[model samples]
Target: MDKNIKVGMADYKVASGEEVLITLGLGSCVGVIIYDSSKKIAGMAHIMLPSSLEIKNNSNKMKFADTCIDLMMDELLKLKVSKTSLKAKIAGGAQMFSVSLNTESLNIGKRNVIAVKEKLKSLNIPIIAEDVLGNHGRTIKFDCNNQQLNIKSIGKGEHII
Candidate 1:
């Protein structure tokens, strides 16, 4: 919802039409959320890592992008939300790397973005919109009722889709 809502690291929230979910400070992490207007369904996640393989014991599912998205989808299904009609949007992934000026393009943020896209592709989920890659952070808000996404860079305008 909109009243001082807060989603900490590796956290997600779901609600219906009456609520608005938002998250900020997405750099190498991704905000993968889905909205289904007809079903009045919505879900959001903040994925801090790129894959589950890094965790050999199936630990901390929310930390990995793939597992995080799956977690969101799994919960949405429990609400009777069908994946066939689900629409996904992703944001965040900046060159948060300080490796070297020559490696500015090798930020983990870009890797995270690519990982999310690959995961979605494997799941047959289409990305309706995205605002990824750069040397900055991102803030995202999803209005579930209307399936609208509001994306904003730190000092730029909020983009609506």
Candidate 2:
């Protein structure tokens, strides 16, 4: 374990060695995690919004769905993870904004899921699984050792990681 390594919100963390990175409190936010078990490399991102098209003068473009994937992909590549060997798993994207909208078009959670799907498709990275879209919040953890994903909510039961 690396004492210098830490986890936080609205951020993506990766571990190449034995270190494991995690994040939590994902409400209306999406957690996109990519892992390569062969290389013991894992990355997790907590995205708050669907697209950055709304963030005027956006300097932190990596915080958006489109760029976050790209950013994490680049980091993985830098770590020598093959694109074909990499797989994605996502969670959260809850409709917890408290504003009602048509689930088809106006829901930011759906939009985030759609954008993530499209971007991953464009990148040729297949998403293996996901637990997304709901009115409740979620907390996700990714295990680099086994490439397992864990998800928990306020009232839901704990899942494997």
Candidate 3:
């Protein structure tokens, strides 16, 4: 049987073979998935912020896009997964709140999405698919067996990306 590894908010988890990585309640947060298909290795990070530099006492590295991805890559590299073999998939980053003023600072979700993309690009990881930016929260399951990310949202049903 395959093990299901649950990743929480501001957290991350890595798995291999038949294991599946899952995360829930992704409102304004983003679920960043990175995997090496040939090795059947995968990881998921539920990032709550765009950058760690934006806040004081940001000790939780997993909560930000930049730090979280760097840490996850280190783990993957340790597992003998080459950076060249890595691919990515992302979900969540929803605009959950309705604000009267249309300002970039208020759109944390969009900021997160952009940051994730920038970080991935810096590391030369290609995002194969993504489901992001809506007014709803998301729950995601990353299956290591086939490198597929299954995303579920309220009133949006379920789909694999």
- Assess each prediction's global lDDT (C-alpha) against the native: 0.79, 0.77, 0.94
TM-score of model number 3: 0.97
Q: Write the per-residue lDDT of candidate 3 for residues 16-127, one digit (tens) a residue.
A: 9989999999998999999999999988999999999999979999999989999988998999997798999999999998999968899999999999999999999999
Q: Give a tens-digit lDDT track for model 2, residues 23-106.
A: 778776788888887898878877866678877855776678888877888888899987789889988877776665545655
Which candidate number has the best TM-score?
Answer: 3
Write down the worst ten-residue block by lDDT for model 3: 1-10
- Which parts of model 2 are misplaced by more than 4 Å? 2-7, 97-106
Q: Sort by TM-score, best first: what order?
A: 3, 2, 1
Q: Which stretches of candidate 1 lie over 4 Å from their true place?
A: 1-5, 55-58, 101-106
**Predicted structure 3: clash tally:** 0
lDDT (10s digit) by residue, model 1, range 76-146? 88999877888788888777657755663356687788888898888877899888877778888788777
Assess candidate 1 and give its lDDT. Answer: 0.79
In candidate 2, where is summed lDDT lowest over 10 consecutive residues? Answer: 1-10
